[model samples]
Target: MKIQLLPSTFDENGTASRRQHLSCFVVDDRVAIDAGSLAMATTTAQKKQIRDVVLTHAHLDHIAGLPLFIDDLFAGLDAPVRVYCSAEVLETLERDIFNWEIYPRFSELKNKNGASVMQYQPFEAGREFTVKHLRIKSISVNHKVPTVGFIVSDAKTTIALTGDTAEMSDFWQTVNAETNLSALLIECAFPNELEELAENSHHLTPRNLQKELAKFNRKECAIYVVNIKPMYRDEVVKQIEELQIENLQILEVGQVYEW
Candidate 1:
């Protein structure tokens, strides 16, 4: 499996920066895990190939690019873009985002080909579903709103991703049961100094992240940290590095990682 966290911002030199202001991950360039940067950062090829978007939650940073993505491809779509998410997320999207007052409800619109422009495929938490060649299982995680982390498996690779979360136990319990898990893409969103803010926001700091990692039984599995707030990126990275965990590393933005 190949996964790349899409870059959400550019540097002064017009280069993709390491700082992540939004959240989106493209898997094998075919399926999108989130639509945060789906419209802004995808390659021409990726935009054409990725018709399936699996959402982790309905937060603005997570779903900001979704409507734009659908609108951009509205005229040419032969089939609807299939969005896989939980029913709660689906409800949020319809009530908050796709309401006519906010954005055109693509779910109710048809393309030139007379097919719906977008479709929702709601999945229950803890149930495994297939998207293209990958099998995915959504596990509810601790977040400010209703959210989930995922365990994604292709033919040869199986990996876990915590979309945006704080301290979690059920996630680790489910992940530890996966015998063939190769990697874990976890989130540490704030610096240790902001522990109170992190807790109130339901996000993780480096200090608590270490505690969460202790629940994992697989000591050898590669761990990649993600979703650090852009302004606090350096401090969070420095703090995580100070932990001196051999297998842990920060996942680079826009870099494709394969396992």
Candidate 2:
């Protein structure tokens, strides 16, 4: 499996600024984790192969482009695209995002042949499930909303992605326990100067994130950081550098990573 950061704040030089958020990973080139940037970031050929989406939560920044993503590929799909998430997240999507007033409910909305474009598949919080060729588990994390971080493994390569969290222990514990973790995509959203806002919003600053990482027990694998606020990016970068974590690397969107 190959993972690529899509339209994050530090997206590489060529990607457009207006439609930036998050997305695009290749699980045999078929599964997408979050659809926020997939609509605009991917080519038509790539969209046609996206058979499943494992959403972390329903926040606009995480799931905003999902509706348009479905619409763009509705007619192009051979079968329904499976959407996996917690039961609570499904309810939030129904009530807030896909409700008729906001956008056409893709679960009920159909394509040219009257088959639905999207299908909601509820997943358990700590349970493991298979999507395509990988084994995946959701680890609950502290966020403003009901959110989950994901761990995906193809046996040899175990990768953990903390969707958005602050001072999480359980997820890091699980990561440390896993024997073959190749990479970790953790988050550092605000600079230490914005510590108050980061705390209020359930996000992490460099200092707090340092403590959170301390819980990981060991720095055995490559660590890639994501989700910095655009306005305070430089400050966050400086602070993260000051932390002096040896194996850490900041994720640049549009860069393809193989592990």
Candidate 3:
């Protein structure tokens, strides 16, 4: 499996920065785990190939680019863009985002060919579903709003990703049970100094993240940190580096990793 955390922020020189303001992971350039930077950052090839978007939640940063993504290819779509998400997420999207007042109800619209422009594939938490060639399992996680983390596996590689969340038990339990796990992508959204804010927002700080990582049984599995707030990213990275845990690293923005 190939995974690339698409870049959402850029520097003054027009180069992509390491700071991640949104969350989107392109897997094998075919399926997107989130549509955060989908409309803005995808390559021409990616834009043409990715028709399946699997969402973790309805957070703005996670779904910001979704509407635009559909609009970009609205006229040419022969098949509907399949969006895999939980029912709660679908409700939030319909009420807040796709409510015509905010954006066109693409799910209700059709292309020139009479094909639906977008479609929702809602799945309950704990149920395993298939997106293209990948099998995905969603586990409910502790977030301020309805959210989930996913365990995605193809025929060869199996990986787990914790979409923005605080400390949680079921996610860890499910991850630990995956015998062929290749990598674990977890989130640390705040610096250790802002532990209180992190807790209140249902996000993880480096300190709490360390405690959470203790629950994982696979010592050899590669661990990558993601979703640090753009402003506090450096501090969070420093704190995580201080832990000096072997096999732990930050998932670099815009870089693809094949496992």
TM-score against truth, every candidate: 0.99, 0.93, 0.99
Question: Which residue runs does candidate 3 get wrong by more than 4 Å?
Answer: none
Instruction: Give the runs in model 2 whose Cα sits over 4 Å from its true position.
Output: 8-20, 23-28
State the lDDT of candidate 2 residue by residue for 1-259, as single tens digits: 6887665433267654422256444455677888777677765656778878898888777787678888887886667888999999999999988899899888987777877789998999889999888899999999998889999988577899998888887787788888788888888889998889999998999999888888876577888888877677778888999899979978877667888
Candidate 1 structure quality by residue, lDDT tens digits, 54-148 = 99999999999999999999999999999999999999999999999899888999976898999999999999999999999999999999999
lDDT of each: 0.95, 0.81, 0.95
Question: Which 10 successive residues of model 1 have the least lDDT summed?
Answer: 104-113
| Backbone clash pairs in model 1 (N, Cα, C under 3 Å; residues 3+ apart or in different chains), count | 0
Candidate 3 — what's its lDDT? 0.95
